[model samples]
Target: MYDQATIGARLRMLRKWRKLSLVELADLAGMSKSYLSMAERGERALDRRSYIAALADALQVSETELVGGPHLTKDPVQAAPHATIPQIRTALIANTLTAPLADQARPLPELLADMDRLDHSKYKFREAGRLLPAIIDELHVHAADPADEAEHRLALECLIEAFQMATFTTKDLGYGDLAHIAAMRAGEAAAILGDPINRGKADSLRIHTMPATTWRVRLTAAEQAVERLQPHVKDDTGVHVLGMLTLAASMAATVAADASRARHWLDHAAELAGRTADAPGDNWGAFSTTNVNVWRISLAVEQGEGGGVLELARNVEERRLAERRGRHTAFLTDVGRGLARDPRARERAVEWLHRAENVAPHKFRNDAKARETVGVLLQQVRSTTAGRVLRGMAARMGLPH
Candidate 1:
């Protein structure tokens, strides 16, 4: 029943009741002026859990109380004609964003439920992306506190995952800039919680945002993050090491872009994954040997090594088919693009690209290199209907026009 207009009205009421200007509220809440303005106007939505908590804290009320009903019902405190922090937070978290509360015993179930809800919801990717920054800001407010550190950390991780989903699900979304900012913020928050796994995840995202042409910048960020995390790497028997190894391998892959370098990194990553597997623990973030293989396949495709790509692609396909969750849409996109460039494999490459698109269009939409590969295939099938469809898709995705 909660609508954007109602949410905006409540936010304004709360600010006025507290006698705080928008600038003051934004400063106290650690958000930008523009975001605050949009929230007050109900032009923006909140999506991050931490942000909701922070808004609740700033308004000095429980999130449940703010959204469900105002406190002190006996006297029937007049519904303050203003926005309460908690109300704003609740409205945003419940309506705009998709981050779930970290249920200590039911985190995965909670996340799955939320994901289902998102799938069924009316919100589209463009709207969701627009709401992310404010959600991140709200999450920041809660994450800054030393108390409730574990809950705060989990919320941050959830936010990071949500951001990833937003970035990966929307075609031609133009969210790379926002993704970088959110990843950096998440990294800072993860660092505060002393959770190396989250920290490494954030680092990986940060590296991903770097342009491939700017290898030096990416290398420096990766190396620095790894060095900073050196102390945490001693214990390699948990999900933490898997994240670290993935971050390292991803960075090394960016550096050399060669099969040998990639193989070395994957070997190390596999070793760490194996050690973690030997320990009695459920894998966090789905870290496993198969993940290492995916990374290896991606690298081989990147390096343009035909035999390696074919072998690795076959392995990935077989494993992914066996494990429904391990499907690497990004890796398949790479393979398709690679084959699309070669005359012999052009048909096969188009098939791969088609499959990749079906799986996740957003991931491959903005990739210029992939578009170039598809372009080659287009030339071979100039008069075919498939070529026209491919060309149209490429244009829409901002690939070579």
Candidate 2:
């Protein structure tokens, strides 16, 4: 019985359940038979978006089914975020601009202030999930019935911010349906608000929230978004938003295996990042030199370029990323996952993952890639400390150790 709870295990089970030979599945997924065998045996990591998407398509399953998401933890603290998804979904689906679910609404400024606080939390998924539903309900009330045009604009801005946060919260917890709805809500609000930068922000969120299975379509949309935002890139916020969109395009390119296009998009983003300050904690997307490097490391990992990842990490401004919990943890997590593929670097991988967990345990524990990396490293455990750390992470994630 394959009960290891890893993607490779799931792949093997699904393949056998469908009565397909290893070579058959590989042929369906457009991969070599030997590569598919290695992936099924857990000798290779299925960490790339393209591979997972391809396998899921071949298996006639959703990507989430293959990835085994909406993970639940035995720890009450870690499971708290998952509990909030239901309310968020209800709030998003059941409420309309003219009709809100909540009875009383708070002032616009107060709600906006709350949104700002949540933004500065730096991807504390639990906190955002816990507080966003009520704020979203209230913000919709204000947007539905405002005093004046100025008040309505403020309400739309806050609503867009809240929707973006909701998208992040739900997306991380594997609630893809709610995430898509939240992103659409943001884009609608941005259109009404008629702010080009906010529209660009909403567009970037849409790109990120788009399903990886549609990499070709997403790549085209990202390219169009970058062009749309080009003339509006007259300020730092515009630059940040545009840079994020460019990065999104690069990610899609990477998933599609268009290395040349991905590098071109990344280089353009790097140039844009240089024009702005490294504001990792900004309400806008954290588009800075450090953030660019973080994306570079993650993209390199997706492409299975372990050596290139570290070389790219050399340019990450550690001091700037110190208190930016989201970007900091992301950088560490990708680096750890990137290095986990190398037998000699297993211990270093554990150390990097541990640092990331310390910075943001909630975010780190919920990360699907981080969980897969831990599972893969656990299978090859050697060093006592590394094994211990991997086991601890597995326990926290409610996975068998």
Candidate 3:
């Protein structure tokens, strides 16, 4: 390691510069003092990009400053171990950081088509990750185009959709800062749209990409978003947005460990669902009966109702959900979690989770709930064949060793 700009040395200097002891820094970083010391001394390298970013955040400095600038790349996706995500890194860096050139803009129709493709599952995790940066970049151009006001409004709305997908894909791939960037862009587009439903949609997405916020804060934000769109319930667009917001609220309530409140929010979402004719899987396509069923399985797993999760999973129309990779991943992972609760069924649990990993390794890898689910499943088994397989699968997905 270099002397002045080595990550460890920088960490030490920054801590001292900030008047923080090792204990204080460790507490802020959510790491043990010994580990923090090792990192500060460069004995144990802070190898992962996520850890570096988190440490930089804890130190109240830019990642560039934390690493002393130009010495190392801060994006984990650019690091050696994550060869799979490098393509996304390339896509993200290919365009302007803040704006897209008007001349480089993709056609307005093309932008909407990309959003539809993404919503319909034509673009899976890998495809979407590669495409989203370009889509967002082009939308950036459209958002600021000084064309007709009507066309300008539509462009802004499309920009919001593009940014939403970008946030989801990047966040799922564990690029937290990139996700926040997309989310802020989405919020900016929402303000340009100046519509109630569009505004609420942006707030709902913050539940996922808002950094370091508690589930309570997220849940409140979601509920407020839903309420904001409630007046427009007669509008199909508003109904669709509310469906998503309420579902987000339900998920956050689950995180808050309030099963009753979670179910209450979900039931409200179902009421909204009934008002809609069908799963308009393009706009709010992720908010349908199938999505709700999938969510029930997830919340049940989190709330310790394994039986309920299994029963809900059975009711989920698998074929109907096949086109929606994200929800389907959640459904299957929760099934694995529920089965892992039973000793006799724990082996099957590993199989189900393994299936999820095979289908969408990136999404499973970065999902906190999915990680916790697999971690719980790992603890439920011993040196049986299934236990060994679970360990192997977890290792492949980069679960904690």
Candidate 4:
């Protein structure tokens, strides 16, 4: 039997050790203090996905630790080669293949091959959302027997992947509520599985770490994740990848105007990236100098560093044009163009954004950041030529006259 109070106590202990007040932790985790307190006191259980994720984030621990304590040992049970679990795994693989992409016209076989090449494991653990519910149901049926720990673990891993996918994609698509829900579910599954990596990835998906925030808060969260992951990260490659993520987080803080923290994370990311490059093979999600340079350019843009903007914009544009695949490529190219601040650059950016709007109209309309970017561009370039271009684009997009 699971001890609810023990789990709560462990959570409380982790929070205290991190030296965080309930309110401070809640803010960091993007949760409510009352809900956190309730969970700590064992007065209320976490129901919503965001609340559970918030708890995991605040503790700087994985979902597995919160859900399954040390007491729940893995049972020794082996299944036959064609067992129920194996069948379920097959179904999962199929489901993943058939999963829809941003562009539905693409054939499933072609998309699946592309997905295989992209290395989903490096991106997100699970591919949760509309796709995995059926598989989860089947797994639940198989998990009826108490001795099915292996199957349970497999199920949990799939669920984790689903949530991870949802969390990352939703945030990218600007669906905060959906992302939160997915992240919360991912955390819950991680707790059940007792895996710190799952929890770490889930926490990393939290919206608080998004580049939309002010520099101070973003920097703190990035630092906290790095500190927590450092001991567990074994090699230089792991360190570099983690540093890149931390730097991205810190970049968000810089955009929010936290210069000191931004510099700290930037320096750390640079150091780790250098060390990784010097050491060995392509480990930890292709930590190349190209990616590092992209991060540097992105950081400089966020800081509004005028001198570096033109060079960085030129590099990103060339690279983006060279690798002209994926739904995001156009928008990324437009983002690069936006950094140029030249009249021709602004014109190109507006044109690219217009094309992006056509390809994914709902995406541009729904995304707060995309809308905000449009607004910012309008304010930045008040010239009559820019105004005429903006008006034409707005008219074409069917915006209010």
Best by lDDT: 2
TM-scores of the candidates are 0.56, 0.95, 0.72, 0.53
Question: In candidate 3, which residue pairs get closer than 3 Å at backbone N, Cα or C atoms, i.e. clash?
Answer: 281-285
Cα lDDT of model 3 by residue, 319-383, tens digit: 77667667677678778767766667777778888887666565665554455455555555786
List the global CA lDDT of all models.
0.49, 0.83, 0.66, 0.48
Candidate 2, superposed: residue stretches over 4 Å from native: 1-4
Best by TM-score: 2
Name the weakest run of 10 consecutive residues (lDDT summed) in model 2: 1-10
lDDT of 4 by residue, 1-401 (tens): 22223234556777898898988888887767887785676443332223444566667665545543212112111101112323333333333212311122223234334433433322121222233344334433333332356755755665555455445445444344545666666666667776545555555555343423233455566667677677776666456547656766666656555677777777777677666652212334234444555566556644444333556545443332222122233334335334434544665556655655554443343333233345435544566765676665444323322
Q: Name the runs in model 1 displaced over 4 angstroms.
A: 1-141, 144-174, 227-260, 276-286, 317-327, 382-401
The order by descending TM-score is 2, 3, 1, 4
lDDT of 1 by residue, 115-149 (tens): 44443333323234444434444444443431464
Better of 1 and 2 by TM-score: 2
Local lDDT at 257 for model 2: 89
1-401 per-residue lDDT for model 2 (tens digits) = 11347788899989998899988998999988898787777766788799998998888888887887686677665677888888899888877777878777988878878877777765556678788889989988888888998988888888877887788888877778789899998898898878788898889888888776889889999999999989978988888889999999999999998999999999999999889887776626778887888898989898887644677878887778755776788899999888888877878888888988888787788777787888777778777878898899889877788
